[model samples]
Target: MNITILYFARIKEVVNYSSEQVSLPDEVETIIALKSWLSNRGETWQKLFSGSGVVRAAINHELVDDMATFDEGDEVAFFPPVTGG
Candidate 1:
């Protein structure tokens, strides 16, 4: 399925792109799987999504957990945890 992936905050700087359109292979079905798939791109991806960072996700503008399932044309976004003072 095809999905639009967005990067925000530190993720955008790490990934080097604000957004991208990706065609996911059939094996990828959830947000966690998507992260693994993207991480395979290179060292940078691996480091950014290694689960050691406070990464947050949203689908179609709605916050979702790792198990969230998405379909074609879905907009998936990745960002760091927000903090306020």
Candidate 2:
């Protein structure tokens, strides 16, 4: 399946990427699976996606937890916590 991933805030800065189009393997069918897969890329990615502090996610502009599932053509976004006064 194919999807668009968007990075925001600190995530964007850390990954040095704003967005990307990725084609997933069959086993990568959930948000959690996707994160684990990406984490396998290398140390940089592993540190970003793995560990205790998992960046927040949004599927199609709506915030969702790890339980959320995605499909072809989905738009997924990852970002660090946001705070404003």
RMSD of each: 1.2, 1.2
After aligning candidate 2 to the native by TM-score, how far in Å is the CA of 12 from where it should be? 0.6
Model 2 Cα shift for residue 56 (angstroms): 0.2
In model 2, what lDDT does residue 61 have?
93
Report lDDT (Cα) of residue 34, candidate 1. Answer: 98
Candidate 1 lDDT over 13-78, as tens digits, reads: 888999999999998979999999999999999888885897899999999999999999999999
Q: Lowest summed-lDDT stretch of 10 residues in model 2?
A: 45-54
Off by over 4 Å in 2: none
Task: Locate the minimum summed-lDDT window of 10 residues in model 1.
Answer: 46-55
Candidate 2 local lDDT, residue 24? 96
Give the alpha carbon lDDT tens digit for every residue of 1-23 in model 2. Answer: 99999999878988899999999
Q: After superposition, how far is residue 40 of candidate 2 from its true place, in Å?
A: 1.3
